[model samples]
Target chain A: MSAEEWEKVLWKTQSYPDNHIPARYFLASLRKNPNFRPYTYWPLVLASCAITQHLATIYIFLAVFVRLKECSLDPRILVWITVACFIGGYLAWELLNCSRSDTARRNANGTKTLKSSILVFLALMALSPVLKTLTAATSSDSIWALSAFLFMLNALLADYSPAKLGGQVRERLTSVLSMNAAISSSVVLGSRLSDGLAVFALILFSVQAFALFPMLRQRLQATLTIFQALLTLLLSLLSICLTASLSATVSCIYAATLVAVTFVAPGILVWAQKYKNEIRGPWDVAVPKVN
Target chain B: MDPLSIAMITDFFHPNVGGVENHIFMLSANLLRKGHKVIVITHSHDPDRVGIRWMLPSLKVYYLPYPTIASSATLPNYFTFLPYFRTIILREHITLIHAHASLSPLGQEGILHAHLMGVRTVFTDHSLFGFEDAASILTNKLLEAALKNVDAVICVSHIGRENTVLRGQLFEKTDEDPSTVAVSGNVFVIPNALVADQFKPSQIPDVSQPSSKPLCVTIVVISRLAYRKGIDLLVAAAPRICSAFPNVKFVIGGTGPKLNELLQMREKHLLQDRIELLGPVRHSDVRDVLVRGSIFLNTSLTESFGIAILEAACAGLYVVSTRVGGVPEILPEDMISFANPEEDDVFRAMSEAITIVSQGKHDPWNAHKRVKGFYDWFQVAERTEKVYESVIKSDQRDLWTRIRRTMELGPFAGLIYVVILIVNCVFFLILEWSIPREDLHFVWMHWNRDYFIELSQKEARKTSFI
Candidate 1:
């Protein structure tokens, strides 16, 4: 007749009606957001920096392509700038690897890096003529459209997480596809250039920006947040500067995207935390604890 | 109270042996015994067993022509079931619709269109689902929509009731406090029951005792070899138990995707001599398998109502089970052993149970008698009849109220269900116009239980006389 008389057990026959809701015990075990941890605005913005960096790389590649097409920059100078970037990036990598305990392994890895870089450099030099004519029969409009589509795929499929295994590259299927897509897009776009040297410079630069830079960025994000923020700022500014004189519309779009990614998206996510509700109770499939 | 015609609708029924299927059959048979007219509606099975059929005790079944998509469940299409449901409800003069299971599309659709025939609706949710996984979230929303205007909701256990209340959104803002929500007054807890006669303890003693082992204890496990059944815990604990107690053996019955793991464990531990695997046990032979052992081990990670556990206890096996949903409420502490769903805890519980069985501290006959007094199918039917009486007396929800309540599903799903509700009404109107009720055939010859008994007796006597 009263709330105290009702028990949660089903064995004993009770005086109350079957549908009678126990005023005190109904849904007493129901829990909301039992394991929820609201994401902070700063950390989310920091995470979004990965995506922003990828977008900036895409815009920078486009700016470089445009400059080469108009003959505003020499292919030899672009090639020299790429070699300087490779050396600077390698020095930064060595500085990061100094914390590792193995000195002998680092010496061996140094030789291996030198050998692979030399091999890739000479290979590009040898294949530039073939790469230049790879898509000669295709229309310039088709090339532009194809490269745009491939770049979008590259940006969407690129791995944005910080390296979990201390900068060792995880060959995820989508990430490999993204690398392939970026390389192929640059190859077709380089076909539009006037000479084999321009195509060689573009191929080398694409390898650095799309392949090597993402690996270094992942390591930087893992090790130093300040470096990641500084790199994101540098890339966004350089991308805007590279596109400003060529097209004002492109520069405005790039600036708006960087602002939205760094500030607006995280703020929206932080505000949306109020709506989080995850129901947990005894009915959930118990995760069995076993050896 | 006058007899009421009830239709038991579900996607799972006879020919598909499962918890839902058996629960429907048993509840329908018990209700028929209580002088209420009962019928079952389900989807057609493969190769055979279609159209109208009769079960024992004159229970009628109508298998609608719809192929099952997965696990004997039909794809949920809101409009396609209305025609068949309308005709059946009209011909059978079903006063109330009792649908079973949350994932059964046939049951949910029956509840959706039951109102068009002016019949009340009752849903019996037999399983528990969490609100986390994508499949659970989708099915919970669908359940919420179907139960928006249901007259009564029944769950099998205390935890199951709470689970279904949240999953089906069976709550309403209180009259005194409009902001705070309270559980709706229609949800009930009617525990599933078994026929104690079927699970009677073994009459003959162990005739073929392995003479090599002086004293041996056979631990029995009868469940689908699946992760949800906590087979990993069994596989992990079985070898340890074999090593710890050289006199102990295992008899595992049933087969599934995880059967290979159990097989590999047996082979790896060199427990091939101690463990016996019987694949795909028939329900009729469950008692035979259970009676061969002294202890029944259940390692289910999640269960709503463990009817199998009760059946084991009735078969006089000392029960050792994971302290999961509703398992604790089935038997008292002294009768059954409990474990956390952990490998070490299960090994500990098994050790205790084996010691108890070896010392003859647990009486199989006493356990059997106690479980018999605990649950019975007739008692479940009597309780379900009370639910039906209350539902019949209660006022049915009107269309406006139903639409208003349904809009609480969500911003998007709410509108979608509202559209389903409106379109269902429009389709009902079309059916009423196209096939007028005056031209349809109404079932005048109802199945009478007394007449059926008399006729069967006569046939039996004639066969014996011949």
Candidate 2:
């Protein structure tokens, strides 16, 4: 039979057998990698900068905890630094809002932020005494292990997307989970402190690092790729310097991890693009477009 | 062709009342009529449906006592199925095993074990699946391993054939062009066929009857309310259709997870009177529902074969379906209307169908006659018999060839499945020793219509004499 005589319809009885492979266009509707968009090395590295920033935050939090735990750093000085970082972060946030020309809700947001900050400060002061002795019964080794695992969980589950900013950016469940994990790690580590003030200072620093810093980072991610890369570099270097003062081996490990996340991982991804075979066709479940 | 002792192995069968279940029953009945023996092997339904049973016209069903994980599919335990499978195949004298539905673990395991019994194997994929989803990726690998040594593959439609070919990796390098691959020649496209007489058009009254009120052009939708069935499109389009055409009404049947959404659409739009929901209509009542409306609307996002649309068309209702998988290949262009699976497009198609229906351009009885000739179960049986005959004539793959073919799956998965293959053979050997073929009860006699009737009459006369 001629190839033209073989129509794809099922209702009719064509002379060809049921197993006939058409001489032309067999399995013609199959579309391989139809929506393929290959990733470039540099662009993927830049996109993965969010992961680098998240890892830096986690490492910096650990360094702060280690300093407070060993009683080597003054809690009062740490609290003063937290206050200064809070003021500076607030100014930067205000600047971001002004540049986006979102002044209509500025007064409302400022008052709300002021109320929440004061409430958290007073609450932390009240909770410091209880938190300092919260896990006194648990061994120090268990506390260290738990905090390490929790920090890893926070890094793994954190929301790394750039926020649109200037709108009600609804928090994702994963981001909430990530925040809780980091705060829980901070509490367990703070409970290992010798004094209540150190616990208070560490808790305050954690609230800034885990909660406030992520929102600021998301807004900053929208600014420029160069800006994000520079911030990632600064944070990673600070984490390495702080860890080096404590231990050389830990600092080297952190540096290697930072380099892997920022450069090596993205290179592997760019190389792995050749293996991506996304077979799409009419057989895929259609996403109905509704008004 | 000589008679084949064929075992229809699937996880779906009677009392389940689904497309696969009905297809197996109908095909088995038709094959029995054609003088071949057919037996169904499926997981037993809950509450008292276990062991061997018989349907009309000598379609024997063996409801194996196996629990299903979800959607009536047994867990794919590679070796455990061999003991039961071996005993059934040996006793029933099954020369070939035909498995249905890719999701059925019983079917895949049957294909994996059939070669060990020295029986030829044929597999039919009844649905289409995307290759990108994680579930599809894992299941497709499993399917690839299961289909590696099967004698033949059957698909319900052309699109389904493509999906199964890719999912099963049923392709080889072409003879002329070694660099290019083609779908294997053994893969066949045998479409699902509906019994048209069951969907015969009723004697619907025309405008000439002059009843108390003028008849309205009703649109009927009969499908399970599921996301894949595109119920969201219906919920979006129903209100707009209601306000656009006041005389047009809807009768939606079948119930599923999306039922609440359809109910909410009806309530929010205040279309309670305009839209009627017949919760869970039986298969026998589908034709009655189809005959109530002049237009049959199907809004499925993905369909392997639109059997519902064919049933509607056979019942004389003009079909207006979302132009989806294998649906376009089912009927002639004039008999149905197609729309992209979008709200505006479906609304457009629905309005056009309404106009066509109201203007009397589409005739129901004429459509019934046309569709009646399009598909028949007996014809499906004959074509399937051709596949079975060819499969039996083909050489069965040896254990070494099966191992080599299984090795082609990939490095990681291929090694894993190869281990499974060897382990399965060892287990079969163990079963052969424990439950030897000599001790197994063989089915020496089958149901013969004439002999059974004569035996029954003789018993009746003896009872009367007593």
Q: Cα deviation of B463 in candidate 1 (Å)? A: 4.6
lDDT of each: 0.91, 0.90
> Which of the numbered candidates is closest to the native, going by highest lDDT?
1
lDDT of 1: 0.91
* Candidate 1 lDDT for residue B69: 92
Candidate 2 chain B superposition, TM-score: 0.95
- Candidate 2, residue B309: the lDDT equals 92
- C-alpha displacement of A76 in model 2, angstroms? 2.0
Q: For residues B174-288, write the lDDT of model 1, one tens digit per residue.
A: 8999999888888999998888888888764444542223278999999999999999999899999999998899999999999999999999988899999999999999999
Ten-residue segment with the worst summed lDDT in candidate 1 chain A? A162-171
- The i-RMS of every model, in angstroms, reads 1.0, 0.7
